[model samples]
Target: MNSNRPGVLILSHCGFSFLEDLKEQLQRRQLRCFVLTSLPLAEHVPARLEQIQVWADRLYTADSHQLKLEDVNNALQTLHKSGEQVTCCISVWEGYRHLMAAANAALGTYDIDAQQALALRNKLNVRNQLADAGLSQARAHALTAPVLQTLQAQSARYFIKPIHGIASYAAFPLREDTTWKALETLRLASVEDTVYASAFNDGLQFMAEDYIAGQEFSFETLLIDGQAHVVAIHEKYEVTETADTVLEDSCTTPPASLDQAQIAAGLQWLEKVLTCMALRWGCYHIEARFTGQHWDLIEINPRVGGSLISHSVEAVTHGHSMLSLWLDLLLASQDDHAPRDALAQQLNAFQWQADGISAQSVATFFRVYFAQPGTLSSVALNELPLAPTVKHILLKAGDVIPAHAREVFLGQLLWAFDRSRQAEELERLAHLSATALDIRYEPGTP
Candidate 1:
């Protein structure tokens, strides 16, 4: 491999399903792709390891599941010494953002700094930043005995969540009877006994924030030079709150509940929030709530939204997934001003339409199915007169669904329909949720 050739470094903790598409796109631009993953190859499934081997020009694996900063720095140093000049670094995994940022800093690439990445990962820090700027109506307190006592005294409803969390783990409504001991027990069980333990980079800390009531939506946005460009807006039509976590099962894009005017207003408010937080560049999956009067912050994810969000966005944008666009943005950031400006213009003028369909007439919806903790026997979707456009199965027969797993997804389905059929389609989705998906555990198993 020529050291002079441009290269992109990807840091991953566990995800690899997107490698094929990402590799094809990168190869088109004549760039070499390198991957550094915390997941040891010996423990990885053969199918996924094959995906990585097919994608990376070079693959480096850490000794453990959790990556250390020193190990990441050493890998970059080795690449540089070998004449592989990595110009950009990226990761879709939230747990590795700081590592990505650090790598970019060392390589003189474009990305937020390590400090900013750390700040963004902490829910408490984000809440305080929004509160200081008056962008949030909710007040958050660290989960301590004193803070719990204070919340009790206020006699107001609040939500408890991990300060550094993924997949809505350890998130629940804070009740009057909720105690510090109960929270600790849940945190230990959820964090220590699960596969995502490494994601909680910031130790076992939690927070309780004032709960805001309204319709929940997420803005899939891109920022260039401090300006926000919304690529898609998804309305969470169905959210289930469990005893320990929150599961968002279904979503529809172009927000079936909000009109064009309201969507425009949301975009404006989102720009302000991003500006206040000083989040200047990259893809952002920002979750927020809309009261009848105004919008409040839920949380801001500095990566592509998970599940089928990237796929749905790609469908609406006529072939641009959040990951693809983010890659383009990173490559463009290293180029001269002319190319960067051109990309900025294109992102700003994007519309949600595909195959010549008008933006208002096209809607993409997806539903996720989850399984309980047990030895899985089988999983399948009953034959439907009309099937979804895409189907993804995450588990197979004989796989054990861990009791402490944050969100054990069985499969996911996505469909595209005309906006006029939104009502009818949603009803069908509800029916599928109740009966279409069949997940069975082993006999006599809970």
Candidate 2:
């Protein structure tokens, strides 16, 4: 019942590894947090529950995957009746962006509309939206049997994936010369993969887009009052996709490899897309490719980048985390009539933090993937750096790993190293991963 403390409603804490860090940040700001999740409270670890009980004002569970708009409004009304106020509604997960928008709109808070949120999430919809804006995008077609036949007849090369996909799930390149048998195999695999893929898409509808060729990069940004501010640009290092999925092997923030002009061009492209999409308030994780001529739109999500990227951002920016900046923007939106210029100034302030770390240090997130399929008996890594670094082992001994599926990774190693030795350190890190790391499999487990 503390009226002075602003309240935030977060949806579905499931499958998010960094919820504790997020909760700690909110706690430090003295904000009252309420989590509405589909997971039962009993399923959580007692230690986790203790921490949640300490910080979260309430954790409500429902039967649905994402709480419906009416459900969220009812909860907000009940909280108001109890002398609590929910100032904002948002979710850090990619799957619930639109659902969060619906709740925010219902609460008369700052948010993107449901329609726009959908466009941001659905890749095909985004391509269409950018095309309408005269923005260049890969030519795409829906992946139907007839459409595949038609494309085959025309002999075109395209990238095929589900309408709503995540982490490169069900994403593959379709060759014009690909046989019908190969297409059928891909379709069957996609249907199976979609069953366990992230939030949206049932693996039914897919699209084939003209493959945009170039080196890929991720631009982390924030849109406030219709202005897009670039936080950091990451150079995504991906291994060749001998398999169906192409996942990021690692990524370096501030992309030391890219020159100033290239960085500006990437940010400019982001602003163009944001302008066309009319994003008013939120964080954006945009992936694109630079063809040495122009930047081609890959996909844009209206949420913070996943996989603990915020930790690396904090390391690079001293202490400013993208989540904190985003939360600050939401808090600023509490003003019923804040001028756009004032909001623009706030954007500038955030940009200063992001730009301040450009010259001091560089951060990298290295993902470890096992090429062989079997039950992992044990894994060992070489001596890790004594400096600030975070390591996560996703799989343990005796866990079965599927063949050629990039979704399941052995672990991730993140570190913030000296800027001057970035190239040397990266090469050393790669050598250590290949030579210093050892993996053993259970006998006859594959």
- Model 2 spans with C-alpha error above 4 angstroms: 1-4, 13-17, 40-55, 64-66, 153-155, 176-198, 336-365, 368-374, 385-388, 400-406, 434-439
CA displacement after TM-score superposition, residue 187 of candidate 1 (Å): 2.3
* lDDT by residue for model 2 (1-446), tens: 45667778877644243566667777878888887764433434455556566667876655543456566666777777778778787788667678788887877767788778877777887787787777875667777778887876775567877688776765777765655566566556654442244354454467888888888887777777776777667777655564567767777766756676776776777778778877767788888988887888988878877765676666666776778766766666655556445656655643523222335355564544544677888886666454327776667777776653336667776767776777877777665554445678899865
lDDT of each: 0.79, 0.68
What TM-scores do the predictions have? 0.92, 0.85
For model 1, how does the per-residue alpha-carbon lDDT over 1-446 read when each residue is reduced to its tens digit? 66467788877775363666667667877899887877643445556656688758888877777777887888888888888978788888788888888887787667788888878889988888898888888988888988888888886889999898888988888887878888878767755643578777746688999898889999888878786777888999889888878899899987877766677677777878988888888888999998877889999998889988988887777778788888888887764777678887787556432221224446788998888888989888888766887788888999887776267778998888776887888788767655667888898777
Q: Considering every candidate listed, which one attains the maximal TM-score?
A: 1
Instruction: Provide the RMSD of all predictions against the true structure, rounded to 1 decimal.
Output: 3.1, 3.8
Specify the poorest-scoring 10-residue window by lDDT in model 1: 351-360
